[model samples]
Target: MTEISRRALVQRLVASTAFVSGASPLSAAPAPNRSPPPPAPPGKFEFDDVVRRARDLAAAPFEPVAPPLPDALNKLDFDAWRDLRFRPDKAFPIGDSFQLQLFHLGHLYRRPVTINTIRDGIPTPIPYSANLFDYGRTKLDKPLPVNLGFAGFRLHYPLNAPKVFDEVIAFLGASYFRVLGRDQRYGMSARALAVNAGTEAEEFPFFREFWIETPESGADRATVYALLDGDSTTGAFRFDIYPGVDTAIEASVTLFPRKPGVKFGLAPLTSMFFIGENDHRFSSDFRPELHDSDGLLMHSGTGEWIWRPLRNPPKPEVSSFLDKDIRGFGLLQRDRDFDHYQDLDLAYEMRPSYFVEPRENWGEGRVDLVELPTGHETSDNIVATFQPKDSPEPNKPFNYGYRLIASLNPAKLSPNGRTLNTYQTTAAALGSPEPINPGSRRFIIDFVGDDLRYYFSDPQLVEVVPSTSQGKIVRSFIVPNPHTKGFRAAIDVQLEPGQSTDLRAFLRSGSRALTETWTFPWRAS
Candidate 1:
């Protein structure tokens, strides 16, 4: 399927499972099983137990269980599917600060995922029942299956206010899940794995079952484990989630590949870049810009910081940054000004940026950025992930760990000066009589930081360094921007027709660097 169709399908699935308000909190009976077998002994369940299951599954041939939806739900539309809302009164209380809600299966979400609650190292299945939901306005032609299971689930906590519980994280479709910080709206998502992403034979690895551990009564964090299954691989995952002003999730993943030489993208991030400061192709909208993430930020092993501005290319584009023992990377929404987006309801300015800090050494790998062509703002089209130099041996355990931070504060992620804005225009200055050269482009990059303020007094001491892979740099210089209290780097480049260039620029003061390297890929029409 095309990227557009894939995104559209996910959007529909997400809309069908959005949360709805309930009347009051009420306690319900223990979730009855679907004639389940005897439960495992207490204290026998742990991370190793899930790993054993993944290994056994990988040893066998892959079996898909895409059961057809019931007639009552298969024909339902968006609004109809959304009407099957899980009762908030039925929310499972994990501790004093956390509660869990389930999603009903319907619409584009046809496959069912098994959910279990782990207490005292004992797992209990949460069965499906019509009484668990309130189907409003939609008439059911037949009763649903007892083993219908769930589409996915979400966790709630007091993130913003003390009394009222707000949604902190949600796992709804595929191997996709999104988390939010205090005061931030949902934006991008973090996936378990991406197999052959941005290619015709791309595969999606999904979580077939989940085990959520009940935290202690006064505990501040929750632990959830998952068993992932795909045609290419089987894996186990553990998320120790801490929700607060800056929500952090410590993730431990173990993958057992089913086939040899299959490309895998670990700790993948998926987002949208419909329009942004660097993309000026679409200007008919009243809002100036719309995007979940504006750029890809990475810290290489050699201690170099690079920021690549995202673009909505006319065709698919993929860029890879080779590294060794990589430190960290993320998709960031740096433009927090509300005026820049002119969007009130969506609150694009309040979207959180997700940064992934590796907990274990990821040796000799490349961070890949995939930008798919997108015409609408609703569907996500950007993906970033880390691919190792060597593929994991089939049916063997491949372990990795990372900390995923979803925060609104982007400054703490890096210490040096960061890219403030990136603008592209014609080579000729505005209102100048110089003939327009369509093949020539001028890029202006502004950087801001505390260290840059010290250089304001000696602006001429800072130099602008620009480089291009397939173009000639006509001119490059640095100038002071009094308004932002920073310096702007401007570069003019001339490119041959149909030629593409990978451009990079940074600022330096004598022997010291002042800002992170700003990179962008440009193609002459």
Candidate 2:
């Protein structure tokens, strides 16, 4: 399958995004003599100062920066955007371990964020220079505006090897940013804030300004602060990143809602789930699987671990898992076998899964999961976020925070064993001696962990607890799967035609839970 470029995908999404309440600078005519923004908030800038700025911005009407970029630069396409590359020596000098690289403005990215470098608690603006970038083939016969700023910036550090800087994280496009580990490529994205996602009138917030601090020499972490603005809300966000085999970003957010009763989704994750092991809609394709993530994994507040396999349903499906004090949740790419995808160019196996761990006490909320149908793998159709039970009223203060970790093996993310594989078949001929319930479907869920191995020595010691929301569980049994060297829970259930059931299963022996509960919504075919 021919996939679209990431820039093209983001640009398309930006077009669909709803950012109102404020006049956008994109459609505004450019002023010939564009000058730099009238200086930012004065004095030594700190975390609380950023929060104060967000509050102050929320009190007034939004004013966008006027652009002076030539129409020629504004009309470039994806190929032309790719041609404009930042030269190496132009990397921002932050520290010995990390350097910053900026993204050039293009048709896809119109809004230019004010980029500043913070040192000794003071801010200094980074001037826009045409000398910093090389315009490969897009011949710009006219001189561009000297005040034209950048779209966004990416962090480059020696994540893979010593003395070699590799891009570990990037902040670009409408409140969207992506992270990568040592050997992983960018597949999924996490947004700063989501407003009315999965609804008719969804809003996309924008990061209009950024303050990247110079990291201490030889330190392992770097801190970046941002000022966010949108039609519905304004906020301040601080991100602290530690890059390695598994990159972890500690994010602190404070939201100021302009209008009351606006739904807010904190730490939202967006990914692609075109097809996977459970779905055969794309069985005729060259690759067996096409997805950035195949399941949603969560560690609830009550210490119950749940794994919900992803699907491109016939219609838009949204599920909410209520929690009192949510621990963590994330969209996971569980299957890691190269043979599963068989694509040499896009190594689906190397895609990183992001987990959001709550830092403060989230009193009560529901982790919302949204799955939108898609025909191709290029479009991201899956979105998940934490919806608080009670939102702060308009003109009130709302603050939340989470730690985001980008990794491949979520098995190490929590203490409980995880679901290794899951499949549902129409026929129930395997593992059953006699013809059991008529029209009953079969399910095989494999789990592997330390707790399971302790009980797998004696298969009878394990029990499969299966339950359905509105169906009859004909039978349930547990057996040791030699393939995974773990316990496999086999279940049979019968549901009438046109009926849908929410099924859940977990392995246990006596009072001990062996694996996380595997849950799925099934519709009888």
Candidate 3:
């Protein structure tokens, strides 16, 4: 069956289950789970214990389990779910610096995730109580079970405003977790691990349980441990989260593959790229651009900076940048103009960009980007991950660690110039009677930096170095854009039919480079 038909069938099944459970018609039933048996007893509950549990679970055949959601809780619709609020007084106080708020199971989140709080080296499971939540207008059945568990949890701290505790981190569906920096709204999501993404057989590993280590008074950070389970792999993860101006989370992951030759994506990120300045296919709105991230920024092993604009293509597109012992990569929302996205409620402009910095050398691999076609901005269509050239062998353990930073401001790892904006325009000016050029396309790129400004200020001080692999560079020029106080590089390229071009451009003053190299792929219409 087609993907659309399969999706429709799943939707119908979810609706039917919700209806039978007396939930709202629009609510999706809990995901059909292929559950594993309870883990065997270990001498000690350590990181290895988590991996052992995952491996033992994967050894047995998968069994599906239906989450037990009470009728009253399951009946909540969107509005009703929003109305259910956790009591502030009951929040899990992790010292005076941080607190944890539990989310109730309803609406989109129907399955409960196990949560345990660690204090003074002892682990205690957080019990669920209906009284902990206040159902504003939605009446619920009395005396809910204390063992009902929780859908997810959020971490709150006074990062932005001193008078208020802002939500800085959240753990929701599967192995996904989103974090925010000071004065930044959440955007992209990071996973503990990804297996075989973009391949014919893709598997999503989920964190079934979490252990949050309580911090002491005056402590500025905390640590969270999770156990990940999948059909072919099992893993353990530890994240040390520090929320501030440049919120950073240091993660250490150890994976144990059940079978050999399993492709693993270390430090995977999921985001959305609808319509942007670079590529505008369906332009019915006037906002100019709408996206969580505008481009993929990578710091190569040779200290070269590379920037590739994100695209919402007509079809699923997967691009890979081969590298050896890469330094870092991230999905960056470089466009910070509020006028670019006119949506006040969502505050797309203030959304944080995530950067993944490797702690150790990861041998030859590629930073892969998977762009899935999306009709609307609601669905996340962009996925970026690290694909190691070598596959992990069975029964052996593989380990990797990295630091992830979520910040409202763009990363400043390099002092070199940065891409301010990228836009596409007609090759020929309006009202011109020039002959139409089908293969000719014009692209405008803006570079901003103090060094670039000083170098370009002098007359005849800078030159544009542009190259294309599969296309002829018809024209190229560099000029100062007065509006942005930056230099703008315009280039027009003519491609052959059914051909694509990989173009690269950078500004240089004499022998000195002034900007981080910008690269893009142009396809013939």
Candidate 4:
């Protein structure tokens, strides 16, 4: 098998089996017998109780647990794991609006998590059964234990079709969960909290237990409560998720740190960026771009919208924008044209862009973007989060709340104008004869919206405000795009050798801003 296929096969195998064992497949060992734990006490299962439990757990050192998979069952490959499907009839019913599905433990997911159903303020653990799964090609000579916990959980609802149920949200990896809007596929992932990200000693806090509240009949929303545990931090998170054309999750988080001065990242998003219009690493048979997200969109407190295109660089790069009481930020997949992504199966055009809007003032901090080098698009290499300027003191409690909007449409923070596209070409093409020079680069930026069209049509009405550091502007022009009905700006810049340039541009009509500020970084080779 090829290397890619072999790796995929191994991941599938590991994802399906709960554990690895050296025991014989036919040898039947008596299943471990254990009593069912008592249900959570009444009125003792409030959100504060969840936080208290997490804080208690964080007071102790981190303890890793091993999955309980029999050696015979652990040896099952991807195909075998696929055969072990969950029985449809045994699916957990969560009111009329949503249902719950459990993922089995195996290769990719070895850590088992506790799943509980909260009904009328009480928490009840859901026990696992071997019969709940239909082991397809894998032969199981002996029955499995009943207490085998789940790997993770997925939330399902009528997302696209009326009669068919689709998975809208999922909680799997370390405190990581993904949600999809109507007709939108998963792209970026959001975490409950991030501690020490982009640092040499980073920590991944995980959701060890989840409490899914049973929805009422005809309810349009579902509530999920989770307990986050890490080496130095503990948190309680409550998510009120509404799935639709624009799926939204309103989250309230309370964190207690085991150690003081821990850097906390709020509303953190993770994605992948292999190549795009700005950075084309390899020649491919498909379209010109391949990425989960194209740019980082931010709405500053001053009501200015900023678009920063994502890049896959040769080394790790971290950029931070300091702001106080920020409004919102997200990783957007603005390019929705199917022609942009030739791969019809993955449907990159239909992937959702997640925006995090703070409900209240978040004080002072910086929106940090981290881009890492990746050889392929399959690996996630982009991270964006809000890093607080002041670290929370150890043993001190902190609370943060935010609303996440997941949609296929671009965020409408302003009705005026926004960035449509950004591209780079040879500066020499713009009247320069030195076509082989590496320092000469021309950038083309397009701004679209109703305001731009209104301002540009009047003579001497609109002017392009452009600035650059460490570069000289050779030529600049603004014109209307006949195809898109938008204002396009083209600028030729000559960068100094061994120097990087930061370019900023915006459209204004007599001091009235017509478009969002466009900022980009150019590094000379």
Candidate 5:
């Protein structure tokens, strides 16, 4: 839980940017001398310049650059902090395709980030001004300091409608950002990197500055460059964002470690899984399920696809899948039925899933999934990332490239059959002569896909392959699911009292597998 706070606390609700005008009284205007760096000369500004800064910074002791925020802003609550919004008229436009909206420094976001817009090879730093924002209902007795910088920024484009600008992507907090495609609500978020994520000694790297290239008229994409700094490392990143029905961001990252043997996770994702189809801890609630994502989807270099159902464990849990030349992976929301959630305000079904596609061969690494026990829906309890076997050397450059896709149709990324839903209950049935076995449980998994539908008529040929790491599989069988035009695999497991079990199962026809292997971690009550 302490580590969660180190990396800026995850926000479940989208940060509002609504603009209105109001003012208040403050005692004194406490201004810091902090200001953004001077603009680079035309033709001199480049990605290499960011790399040089990172390299130079990594060579020195990490001096965190967080100046104290004014008391007027420091004392404000969430509602009052959100009331301060960037004026729409102050938004920086990029050609005719996209615009950038700034975030004010207050509340949970006390760290400031420098923002610059590059046009025709010249970089222009955006200065902070009270005129840029509409302070709604906030009473500042004294005027705000001129040196107060921005917290972060969000990018907007006409994604859903041709004329109306919708938020496409946002970069805020500590190297944290979320993207949205058409009709998708903010849910899970992607991070530039995670340092010592699954360990007790976790570190959060912050993106301290950004340089965005102004797009040309009629261009469909935008380029953004960023500088990240932390206690262990410094980095330079380039993100090329494309907005569409399935928005994508191609990320090129270069890291320079300040110390040797530091654990680094590339392309990490953060999400919430308070409850789901397989978890009944809070079934008394009106909603059938509540979660931003249902499962962890992975495609190994061996071409085997794996699905692990998310859980809210009794304690912190970390699972790693060993692999070589990793292909792809992501935290996905497979259940999209509105009836499954039934929440009108949140619209959980419309939350987009993020898929990480590696642009190069990242050889010999493990995909790590960390799930922390949580009682509230606001906390992001699930984190997934890829950790390389070899640690980056001190003062050496480490580079990786990947494509992050935010979409409503993550199912299309998988070629094999996928698990539609998972359920668990006591193995005993009423009226049976057999005594109730408290240690026994039954797991029901339904899988659906294009290939599975073809073998629905010949259910006899399909087989359910089940395995348990610490339990006996009493019985395993497959039955046709007429409703989904797929097959349901049921397994009765007898577990040892007070022991936990790791279960894996998949559907197969003859010698060929029809679906991705479904994995789950079950703990005794």
Candidate 6:
């Protein structure tokens, strides 16, 4: 298999049956004489209990400690780890709708997390045992500790087909979690919190424990609770996940700061963008475009929408859009055509775009989008978050909530014209001479929306308005593209050597705005 296909099979867990719970096929019989496990001590449980624990943890000096795992297990390679599968019969079966599977501790994922099943408001912890897994290889004949714990877990449900028991969502590797809608494959991921992100001393607070509530028969939803701990912040998170057309997760978080908040990101969405329509200086591949996400879309509080195309620049880049009472923002994979990405495996078109809708006004914050340089498609190079202007004092209370919708289309989030795609060519292509100034570049930004109506009949009436912050607008115009049925806004700009420019454009006619704002940052190579 190709590298990406192998990675998708491994990372996406498409063939995770061995990982789910059995050294053999899921239909294989369990060890004879093994009976169902009895739930641990049950006690009154509620989301507030997690909040109390986090609050208490923040009151004391932060403890950055984790129990060490067995050296043999720690030294296992990826292939060896993949061979160790959880026995499916050992999963905590919640009717026919949900099944829970645990991840084994290994080299990369060393930190152990607590897992529990909530019954009637009481939580019963699930202990670890070597018999629960099938050790296919590596000569692991020695027995492991009873409290060996687990790395993370995955939830299974019949999303696409009945009796298929497709994996729906997973909480694994730090505070990361991802969900797959009906036909969408895994792409971008979401996090609980980001402390001092993008700075020299940035900290990644992890979810130390998870509490998964029991699912009812034939239920289409489940809830999970998490406790986040780190050097800078301790927080409690509750996620109510509903799987459907656009798998939506309603998130409620409460954070307690251990130190004064310097900088942080809320509802951060992380993705990869190795190469796309905007930048292609580094690509030598067969596919026309390759990325988990292509652009960042935002809906401002003032009822304005904006689209910023993503890029893999020579150096790391970050941009912020300041606003009060922010509405929503996310990294989106808008291009769904398979022709755009011709790879038969790792279907990029099946990736879903996540749009986070704030349940209430998130007062005084800037949507920060950070793009880092990456060499391959495997590494995530993009992060977008809502950075609140004012952070809560140390040891004080802070709370926020939002709804994350995993969909291909972010409808109703913005009603204005949408940016279809962005491409760049030399200024000479736009009627300039060869070797036309080294500082000159032309851009073709296609925007389509309700505003494009009637513009075809009176094409010359509509205009493309463009402006730059640190350069001269060499030329600008708007023309109709019969192929896209949308107006293409073309602009040429001249920049000095080593100069960077912020360009903005939108469709307009007679003192009225015709399209949502399109923003791009350009640096002369």
| C-alpha root-mean-square deviation, each candidate | 9.2, 8.6, 9.3, 10.8, 10.3, 10.5
In candidate 1, the residue pairs with backbone N, CA or C atoms under 3 Å apart (3 or more residues apart, or in different chains) clash, namely: none
TM-score of every model versus the real structure: 0.91, 0.90, 0.87, 0.88, 0.91, 0.89
Put down candidate 3 lDDT per residue, 1-525, tens digits, no spaces: 111111111212211111111110001111113232223245434556566676676676543343668888777777998888899888898768889998887776666778998776567899988778888998876777788877788899999888688898998766778999888887778877777776656666666788887766877787788877777787788787887888888787887787787889889888888888776787787677778888888888787788888988766667778888788888999888888898878888988899888878888888887777777777787788888889988667788888888977774644678888888877876688987588888889998875766755673788888988777998899888768677999988899777877788988888987888888777777
Looking at model 4, residue 435 earns an lDDT score of: 51
Residue range 179-222, candidate 5, lDDT tens digits? 99999999988999999876656778988899998877888888
lDDT of each: 0.83, 0.79, 0.76, 0.75, 0.82, 0.78
Q: Could you give candidate 1's per-residue lDDT for residues 46-80 as a string of tens digits?
A: 88899999999999888776777787777777799
Off by over 4 Å in 6: 1-43, 411-413, 430-435, 451-453
**Which candidate, 1 or 2, would have the higher TM-score against the true structure?**
1
Over 1-525, each residue of candidate 4 has an lDDT whose tens digit, in order, gives 111122122122212212111111000111113232235456657677788887788777877555557666567666765676777778788887888988776645556689999877778988988867877767878766677787789989999998778999998766778899898888778888877777754677777889998866887788888988877788899888888888888788888888877788899988877778766765564677788899988887776777888887766666778787788888999888888788778888888898888867888888887777667877787788988889887676788888888889884544558887898888755575665556877888888885665655662677778878666877887887766677778878777687777777888888788887788777777
Lowest-scoring 10 consecutive residues by lDDT in candidate 1? Answer: 20-29
Off by over 4 Å in 1: 1-42, 435-438
For 1-525, candidate 2 gives per-residue lDDT tens digits of: 011224224323332332211110000111113232223345667677789889998998865543545688678888998899999898987877889999988767877788999986688888888889998997888776656878899999999999899999999887889999889988999989888776665767788889988766898887889999877889999998889888988888888888887888889999999888878775488899999998988877777888989988766677777777777889998889999999999999999999888877787778887776677888888888888878768788788877898998877675777898888875466585776555578888998886777766788988889988767898888789878879888888888876777788988889988788888877676
Instruction: State the lDDT of candidate 6 residue by residue for 1-525, as single tens digits.
Output: 111112222222211121111111001111123232233334657778999999998888876767888878878888998888888888788546788999888857778899988877677889998877887975675778988889889988778887687778988777888888788899888877777666655667788889988756666678788999988889999887887767778888999988885577899888888888777788789898889998888877776777889988666666778877767788889888899899899999889898887878888878877777677888787788888888778878789888888887654445777788998988766454667888888988998777686687788888888888777999898889888788988999999998878788899878878888888888787
The all-Cα superposition gives candidate 2 an RMSD in Å to the true structure of: 8.6
| Candidate 4 TM-score over all chains jointly | 0.88
Evaluated against the true structure, the overall lDDT of model 2 is 0.79
Colliding residue pairs in candidate 2: none
Q: What is the alpha-carbon lDDT for the whole of candidate 6?
A: 0.78
Q: lDDT ranking from best to worst?
A: 1, 5, 2, 6, 3, 4
